[model samples]
Target: MKVLAVSSIGGHWIQLLRLMPAFEDVTVEFMSTKQSFSTMVDGKKFYSIPDGNRWNKYGLVKCFFAILKVVETSKPDIIITTGAAPGLIALFIGKLFSIKTIWVDSIANCEQISMSGKIATKVADVVYTQWGHLEDNKVKFFGNVLG
Candidate 1:
């Protein structure tokens, strides 16, 4: 199966890389923002979508189109992501394309729910929470530290 793992740079990027071993036998594609951390992902099938901040409207448009192109070309069987802006876009596109999606909320939101988690929980096919106590009918408690 082909899986596209998406996440932002920094901590989220680190977590997503941990999922590499799980997809070793399958085709894996990665998408993330440009950063020094991406250097660690050498020798992998990957694409870097320009990071979008709230203020960069032009950049956001460009990145959105870039993301669409990647998803269309890759046609991943499944999409998994950790909370970040790009992940939200991937989740929406994946669902629209009938691709299976797994959205894992950030571990930092241990007590109160995060905005990303809230959005993903409403849309993702499978929603995972790092904290067991945050479990709900629509969420699966996968314990902390997914990556």
Candidate 2:
């Protein structure tokens, strides 16, 4: 299966990278906001989305265009993301394309529902969380599953 792993630049992206080996048989690609992403995950297919910022209008616009390009080119069978804004956008796009989407709640979101978690839970085909209390049926307890 073709997979698009979407996440932000720092820990989120790193966590996704850690999970890569498990899906070695699937064709995989990445989408992130870092300008120097190629240096971080070399020799892999990658698309850049603008970094998240509540005050940067231009960044948001750039991200919109970037998302359009990503959705068109990747055409992935499954789109998975570790939380934050990028995951929210990817979830919406995956829904539109009828792609299977799995949202992995960030390891950081221990008690409260993050912005991405709230949105992704509403749209993603599967929502996996490390926190045991995310009792929603569609949300699975995947505590430390990446390791």
lDDT: worst 10-residue window of model 2: 138-147
Alpha-carbon runs more than 4 Å astray in model 1: 35-38, 55-57
- In model 1, the clashing pairs are none
Candidate 2, clashing residue pairs?
Answer: none
Model 2: per-residue Cα lDDT over 1-147, one tens digit each: 899888887778877887777678998888888768767667678887786555777776677668767888778999998856776778788888999999888777778657778778789998888778964676788575455
- What TM-score, to 2 decimals, does candidate 2 have? 0.88
lDDT (0 to 1) per candidate? 0.83, 0.79
Per-residue alpha-carbon lDDT of model 1 for 1-147, expressed as tens digits? 999999987777877887677788988888998755556777667898988756777766777788899999999999999868788888988888999999888788789567877889888999888888989998888666653
- The TM-score of predicted model 1 comes to 0.90
Residue 12 lDDT, candidate 2, scale 0-100: 80
Top lDDT model: 1
* Structural RMSD, model 1: 1.9
Error of 1 at 51 (Å): 1.2
